[model samples]
Target: MSLLRAGIVGCGAIFPMHAASVAASGAARLVAVCDPDANKLESASQLYGCAGYDRLEEMLERERLDVLHLCTPHYLHPPQAILAAGCGIHVLTEKPMCIASADGEAMIEACRRHGVQLGVIFQNRYNPGARLIREALDDGSLGAIRGARCSVLWSRSDEYYAESGWRGTWSKEGGGVLINQSIHTLDLMRWFMDAEVSRVEAQLANRRHPGIEVEDTAEGLIAFDNGVNALFYVTTAYSHDAPVEIELHGEKGTAKLTADQAVVTYQDGTVISRDRLPQDAMDYGGGAKSYWGVSHFKQIQDFYRSVSRGEAPVIDGREALKTSRMIEAIYRAGRTREPVLL
Candidate 1:
């Protein structure tokens, strides 16, 4: 079969992973890229040997792309995906589906109407640590999940936001640490619980950064419909980007995970652990940060397989909206100081 043609938008920091993944995939080809920045576009065009455009519409019209990857700012996801859907092009977008649940719903509906796939990139799910924990829970090795906790304590200096025009804004990047950095953890929490959220009680603050319009820190308690409770805390005020940690306690055991490793200890004195493979073993040649994990390629390949089989990708719009709803609930709960129902 001929490889599917793929086009990526936004040649920013995250572009390399997407570009390299598509370039390496046997099921797809990187035929085009789009970005408003001329230097980035020209560089990517030269490096990838693909056409680049300053406008998305022009790229869409010029390239016969089967799939379009959105690596753009958070606010641009909804409209861009919808536009691609209208063109009968499948969309694979980076996380936090959109700033609001309604927009996510629209994006999903648009893709459905166009008969196209809409996948969200939650690559962390493919991590060795995540896979082990998910298997333990899925196979009843972890018994009934009682509660969970996760944290993302990473630093983002003033210059980090100052350099990126959309980094700290509510209108573009959505919310600060919660939406930007910790949403992946939130998604993983929900995915592991495999339960609908009942409500959330949360608080948001800008403890360190004074000029930003969004929160630099957030803490929340989420109640799941299955009676499992989760506590989440995130802050971008630390001295460095620490490894994110998630711990799940269950009737049979407790499972703890960092970015590269996971440990599960059962009540009956059995302990299991999984560690990330070395860089060479993973065959990941991209320049993405180590903490980002090496699963973007895995997830992209899965999406290609799903499309080839004419099925929805694992983290399709609806699946991803589960976390988006949770994020929105946390934001509302933070604002009202009351439990917001999902």
Candidate 2:
């Protein structure tokens, strides 16, 4: 089998993870890196031993890439991914796909029209704890889920926003905590529940961040088709970052998870606990430990395998749309102070 050629399109804090994953995966080879900053590009080219380009068009023209990772900013995803897809290259992007659903839909539609894969990065779903929950729920070991809660209480100092100029802005970084930090939790919640969200009621606030237009804190209730109402709360205003918490109550039992562990108990007096890999850099707002999670390698490898086999990735654009739509609903409900029906 031929190796799938891969190129990364950003040299930010998260770029190395993609490069490392490409090195780690047997299915792909890293061919190039791209960024607007010549300094960052120089560093990336040196680090990865690949060609670096200041222009995306130049990279596309020169590199025979089979896969392109959009490690770019939130606002830059659509156009870049669309361009990659137009060139018949599979596109994988970091979370939130885009700040808005319409843009995400456009990306999805374009990939569909071009017959290439479009994947979103929600690596948290690949965790052992999350997989345990999904397996139990799938195998009927969890019976029926009644409700659930997902919480992400993490801190983001003023410096965190100031350093990343696009962050905290509605148009660029999208919403603060909900979009930037907590979207993984949102994706995990939907995956664990395995149901469609029917309605949403939410409230958003920019209470603590000093210089941002987006909400720093957001809490909401999402209702599913089976009458399972779930609660989700996220904020970057906390004094210290905390591990995310997810719990689900079901007819037969309950499942609770944190960054390190997962526990599921059945009504028959049986309990199951699974050890999860340590949560790394992205867990605490991307400062010193940004490359912390091991799931990136797992997901990246899976993506290439899927592509090589002509199968959709586990977290395809359509799979991401479920969480993206819920995010839009939360924002809409929060701004209007009314329940938004999905």
Best by TM-score: 1
In candidate 2, what are the lDDT values of residues 16-112, reduced to their tens digit? 7788888878888889999988888998888778899999999998897999999988999999989999999999998879888899999999999
Quote each prediction's TM-score.
0.97, 0.95
RMSD of 2: 2.5
Per-residue lDDT of model 1, residues 251-307, tens digit only: 999999986699999999999999887762333343566555568988999999999
Clashing pairs in 1: none
Cα lDDT of candidate 2 equals 0.88
* Total backbone collisions for each predicted model: 0, 4
**In model 2, which range of ten residues has the least summed lDDT?**
279-288
Q: What ranges in model 2 sit over 4 Å off?
A: 277-291
Error of 1 at 231 (Å): 0.8
